[model samples]
Target: MTLASQHPMTMFGPDFPFAYDDWLSHPAGLGRLPEHRLGTPVAVVGGGVSGLVAAYELMRLGLRPVLYEAGELGGRMRSIAFADHPDSLAELGAMRFPPSASTLFHYIGLLGLATRPFPNPLSACTPSTVLDLGGVVHRVRTADELPTDYQAVADAWDKALQDRAELSSMEDAIRRRDVPAIKSIWNRLVTEMDDQSFYGFLAASSAFESFRTREIFGQVGFGTGGWDTDFPNSILEILRVIYTHADDDQVSIVGGARQVPAGLWTRTPGRLAHWPAGTSLSSLNSGRPRPSVTRLSRTGEAITVEDSSGARQDFAAAVFTPHVWTLLGRIDCAPELLSVPQWTAVERTHYMNSSKLFVLTDRPFWRDTDPRTGRDVMGMTLTDRSPRGVYLFDDGPDRPGVMCLSYSWNDDSSKMLTLDDGQRLAVVLRQLKAIYPDVDIASHVIGDPITVTWEREPHFMGAFRASLPGHYRYQRRLFTQFMQRGEPDARRGFFLCGDDVSWTAGFAEGAVTTALNAVWGVLDHLGGATAPENPGPGDRFDELAPVDLPF
Candidate 1:
């Protein structure tokens, strides 16, 4: 796509009309350009979604902004492939966005990228889950439909879901230092529910049929790690996820998840600079003064960025958008700016190392089931494949069930990725048999397990950021106070924006939200200032919405 055809929502923002060709054609090649000023008004660092979105928003306002990305533009939405099996693809991180993600949907529409709704639920319990949960299950079918043995299964499920919400609210209150209040409510529910998992809660409730008791147990049990233990969350969290999973329409990008980033780079008009083929950031400046940058530098003056060949050029503001933990203490910044240790404190947040295995076969390996359930043949799992967690989607639009991708997490994929292709294929075959006891795995299994190593990606140390016990308040406060461009008059004019810095935690939407906040904050600070005369073509800032304080 050309500059003229770029999305007006993004193209004309603060960082528009980037020297498009220069940015992509070479790795570290910033290319030959005229001697512009030292810095513009805003500098956006890291070229991932957050950086791209921030720059795009800024450019829309007609601001001349400069973006710096140490590596490929898309931060974590990258895919991987096996050398021999180039046709097969595996997502290293961020497979798809749910339809309910309004922020993500809005951006997609603005960018004109086509999104295809996923035909399957986020996760479908597999047979392994069934086996693990010992199979019988129940639901609050209806008042009259209720089994004679149980008062009402439906009523019980509702009660449990409500109880969970109550628990979570109490937990949140306690975190806010409401100890007396927490103690008052704790006994009421804690005494009523005690320490029962959802499975145990329902089984002993006397509100379900013997069959339903077993089946519901199986459904919530193996599928999500047996409720309480596997999830360890309030019942509210469980119900919310269950409802969202059921109603939300999650979908994958047309070209693959990685295509989003590729599209951004292709669609955005920015100067592309490639470093010398084999030089690291350290080698670029051999014993010279590395440029001093404010965390949120806002001078409306351009700064020279020297590539490995010692070539230098300038652009207005720079925005930084990389992983909070990885970028912390690595990039140059004022010492006082490093006081926020929240990034380092939560480094060990529960993260799963995952491997996505895509297989191509001519036959429909999955048996068709209830159209609503979409579990015709195979089941999914949060546990080892069975009923706990495995999902299947029809690849009909692509090929004849020719492409199948399975995301294996935790110990399920740990040892498998290290093996040779032949060995990995052998294990997947075995596991598939466990998921579909009736299917012929050995006959039509045509591909090896394609892997994407989360542990290997340098910028991303783990999978998505997760909130563990006692971390919610800390997370909310961190994003609330620290993620902003330094005040224009402050000693350090810097702003941090990324998915890690948003309330939504680990998702693309968070990146946009954070970027939006950063943009508004910077714009407000610079609203009173004037730009240099003869600013380059397509350089200005669009009026952005005022930043809304989160309640």
Candidate 2:
């Protein structure tokens, strides 16, 4: 669309306002090189989706940027493969997009990545489900099917989803930055939806008491904690939950999400530089300061970043895109900037744990055989009684059969990730055996299981930011503030952009959208002595395009 619409600052969701190609080719200036260049004008920490988008947007604005990744660049958006069937796609974290994620579809198309409908149909089918409240198991599918006392449990879960649909309709007003109305609605919904955690919500439901029989055990038997055994918290809290057991649209890019950054990195010219191999940020050089930067004292201006070897150099700005939890308490920002109290709720309390496990088989184990009339074989989990973690989607014609993925959250993935590949494969095989008691898993085993846990890596504590009880308002503040010379700009110069800053909460779309905001901030910082005559937002950035320089 027009540049005004593309201004990152005003946008609400994850998708970048401009086309990907236009973003890459946006003109940046030349001829302002410092005597000795260590890093670019910007230093982007952590090369996950947000950091990658930020670096790409900065380069498009004609500014040199240095991207830093302590480990792999993709962060959590990764695809795993089983050793026996290396070709099979085992989605570790997010695997599919809901209809709400249209922006994700647009960006995927822009990248030229091929996408088919998700393989798991289990997400679509309303199967009988069991809720594991503590050690009890309660099965409930529909109101008519509800066990004696627990009919209300079934009713509440369904009603909560309906309420969320109503809440989402208020998006436009919220994005207008109308705090009061939004807060009122938020409180009403939370009180109604979250009187207790999901566990207690279901247990306390009048209908659930009917199902409390000796054979039935407890009312809901889904997740741990007293939260609704099967339903989890209201759909609202479940989506907001920091752990991985989120609704289906958590995404996984085909050919791996790393391609996103790799693609962006390739688009930049030589002005873009990365740390040399085997070097870490602690070893970066401290040399001549950037002539263009004037806010920091000599000590505040630069820090020493040494390589494994003795060599080092100085940098201008360091743009950190690492997980916020890891950076908190570790990175030393000015005391005034640290106004938000460190997150401390049971959920907010920091924990360094994350994991992804990929399970693959020779054919779709769930597919019912019917040679004469081949109907769609796989079933989607509209809601279910089986293990809660398995998600299946259509792999498309290019790949035969179905590709099913299972995701676990919090410390739940520990046992799965720790198993040897063979053991992990066996575990999945055993579970498959439960579904098809007659089939021999040994004959169907096609691949060894594969897994990755971000919590294991010292560089990152977990996936993207999570919303604690009161962090939403502060998160909005993070997006609006801009960094200034003597004081934090009314719009804080050190701006925040990411899922934590977007309307989507925690998704790739949020990161891309926030980057759009950061780009305009940089432009606003250097636009001119006086506001450019036509500086109306996104479109005005084009009018202030930087001078061309020979690469």
Candidate 3:
């Protein structure tokens, strides 16, 4: 995969495009530390993918990573199995991943995990998609089967991206690993449209001038489902995903997304710097991580962490990976731990709200054919009603199935935030009944329903980061904070890593890549250095760092 030819575009860059995938695959390994620092301990302040990756790699680099968690081990990759049927489960947080997330896939491959195509609307894996808008139900095998209104919206969106957002040039640059071109085009957009919202950008597009078109585009959105809830987000946030192909051809892990972090926790690395062959993060922490982190502060040249068990430990360096807002609420963070601008970035971080309702079915009833209409009883669905987007999962004819009854975001999720498990299930069933009146959905349900409003989860204050307009500078500050140079002495050893600390906030790749960034940061802070043959993200920081816009 040379830079000369156009390869499939992964999440390399429209922002910081360092080759984390390459660095991870190198035989020389990530870095080396002084003999005295070989077994030095580093505080990993969260158990999410970001923290897990950070700890896993730190261990491989000959450092001990002490893991701490405030809640579940996997965090947003929350998976719960229905009793006796481990295969039948609900993915309450992240369910699908795009191949463009090369860094994340790298870890998945290392863990020897299998993945299958996810059933997105009108995708090859989806048998059918039913769109219900304004009480009218339209079923389609492909987007072409829908009425002209849908086609018009699709065309308008393409036109809007090309004309208003420079979609083609940016995408071409990314596919070619053209960092200069990527930064050139993206930096101009950041400076020019830092204050623009997704809705505002669409409204300004000549193709999306009609109020009706915008409504339809939002309702019958491409890929997963409607994105009306994302209208208030910064346009740059949307463009970065689009430009990186983060929304295309997504797949779900075989068992569950939880396996990613879970694997990291237990699996021993093939190439470790100091630890023995059987050593793993699980073994390092005695098969379980430390309790919830209650406070974080600077203790004279070291980072001090206090856990729920009333244990306080100071580490030479630390990686912070929880939700950025947690620094303000759940964790008592010292004010001196971050610079003023960095604190402002953390303070202004905007996290999107998301809710999911899932149910285990006696069988894959959604695939059953209707006697009269000859159509499947129900298919993957998209509706403007309360249920919003519904996805069907089938194992085998003999095996039971799972269905994500409703996956809603932002304001839609807000309404269900107050609903209990049963209430949430009832709300989805009510709207689903309106669409499939002839089918008795309740009868097919097997076990208890699984529900979650991420915003309501105490540990995770919100689902994931989605920047608001005028937040470009703030986001840039957070993304680049890992470099840690020129920072006040008090904040030097504390590294920030997670999806929110990345250019593309919601993707797990962000968590993994940023974790790698923190790994490089910690390595350097503790007198370690990457092999000259395989430079890490930090090594390429000056050349490929994200475009920083003036405040």
Candidate 4:
């Protein structure tokens, strides 16, 4: 008898399965631009991870990238720091990341960033977990101790995913990186399930016949938190997360996720192209990015951009990496820039709302054991209440600790949307008191709470895009927009990138991979070609393109 373990699963997609990580690490660089096109100016709107990646690679190819940022660099990867506690950080945006995000990890490795396992609920990194639902609290070290009914609900969801979605086979194909098998299984699912909602998929499954079972599954989801808000979203979205293991084996950056974009901005690549050895994106942009781009339009053959400073620059190409709403509502754009179908997709993009509240504590007081109970005073808490999820961070016994008081999404997030900072803190603290009556979290609090509601942010109207039922067509149109092989020459120069423009939205892996796609688009537009040995995404576009569905 023989046994062979499965290969590690990367975000090598069923949608577009080009090995971006391979292309990046190849001895031959991404591609080369013509001698005449060297030093050509390109507009990169928003200084987020996507924008910075595109800009950095563009600079490496001997092109000039003029970045315009409406807010601070790093976009949704925001980390709030307090004046007194420099060691603690309140991650208002992206806190945890999955290790399967190879493209993003590629940048993390290059930046020399360190990562540790984030304390997810019932995860190995977490000391203990308290699950509170319907005013009942149950403390446990793992899911094994939960009631048999809880296990039943989990088993039901697993059965449905396996039977209805062919999850096991699909995951096996993904682990093997079998392009034909991945495409075969996925394209069929796309055709059959494009119009199906997450809730509908469960309802159709015989294992999840009970409404109560479905409800339990929604409140306490598989790896992350609640899934009730995601019920209305397309089943394909959920399948994408599960198939690629986007929710499993997650880790947080040692310092914070914001360091990724900041590092890219400041880092001088070891392998320099046309630019001098010491040059970097920060150096090229005069130490900082340009102001917000107020207007975008085509002037003859060039893409003209006007910033908040009233300075205008005509570039040979442009890459947009913000939420589509920023372009549609905030910035003025020429109608001729996109096709009619592309405009509809942008207008129809649905985004999920997210809210997070964090507080600095005096010390790791939660680690204090109760004399009577012999358990830590408090554990990472998950409740059906408004707070939804509470995470505790312990640096050391001597140093201060951080507590993520509340993390909510969609309906749960809406409840806290109108509350002020004090009100937000009070709400979560009150909820925690219900679960941990013996412990007083307020007594340990050292500073005012830090909070952010993604929906309230002017530049980013929503947290991230979540395609609703029947949005597969829209998702396809936007993701494939970077391949403008048949577009008019004037319109060809403009391209789009970001998680919003990617199949796997809401994950940074999507953002970075889409940036690679746009980089390939910009290269092709500038009369450049990737080396035959290590072809870019566009180089293999025709062979590995996503399956086209009838409109």
**lDDT of each residue in 309-328, candidate 3, tens digit only:** 99999999999998889889
Model 2 spans with C-alpha error above 4 angstroms? 1-40, 81-87, 102-106, 120-155, 161-254, 268-298, 301-313, 328-354, 365-387, 392-405, 414-418, 470-496, 500-505, 525-551
Off by over 4 Å in 1: 1-41, 79-89, 121-158, 164-247, 268-318, 328-334, 341-352, 367-388, 397-405, 410-423, 442-448, 481-491, 528-551
lDDT of 4 by residue, 1-551 (tens): 11113477788897988889889999899998899998888999989999999999999899989989998999989987866877689888888899889999999999999999999888998888888888878877788977788789889989999999898888888777889999999999999999899999999999999999988888877687668879999999999999999999899998888999999999999887788899999999999999999999999989999998999989889999999888787999987888888999999999999999998889989899989989888888878988888999988899888999899998888998899999999988888888888888999998798999999999998899999999988888899899988798666788889998998889999999999999999999989999999999988888888888897
- Model 1 has how many clashing residue pairs? 96
By summed lDDT, the worst window of 10 consecutive residues in model 1 runs over 10-19
Candidate 2 lDDT, tens digit per residue, 1-551?
64332322222221112232333333432112222432345555556667666766565344555555555556555565556444566555445544334344445665677654443322223233323333443434443654554544435444543444243433433334343444455445544543344444435544444434211322222222122222332333443321112234334456665566555544423443334443322223121112111121112444223222333434444454555555444443443433343222112432324455454555555455435434222332211222334444334344433333334445455555566656665665565445434546456444445565656555555544544433333443444433233443322334455555553444566666556556555444544221233222244323322111121
Q: What is the C-alpha lDDT of each candidate?
A: 0.45, 0.42, 0.90, 0.90
TM-score of 3: 0.98
Model 1 per-residue lDDT tens digits across residues 53-169: 776556444454555656655667765553454444455567667654555555676457777665332232122122223332222212243244333434555565455536345
Candidates 1 and 4, the one with greater lDDT: 4
Instruction: Note the residue pairs that clash in candidate 3.
Output: none
Error of 1 at 404 (Å): 5.3
Backbone clash numbers for all candidates listed = 96, 72, 0, 0
Candidate 4 overall Cα lDDT vs. reference? 0.90
Better of 1 and 2 by lDDT: 1
Residue runs of model 3 more than 4 Å from their true location after superposition: 1-6
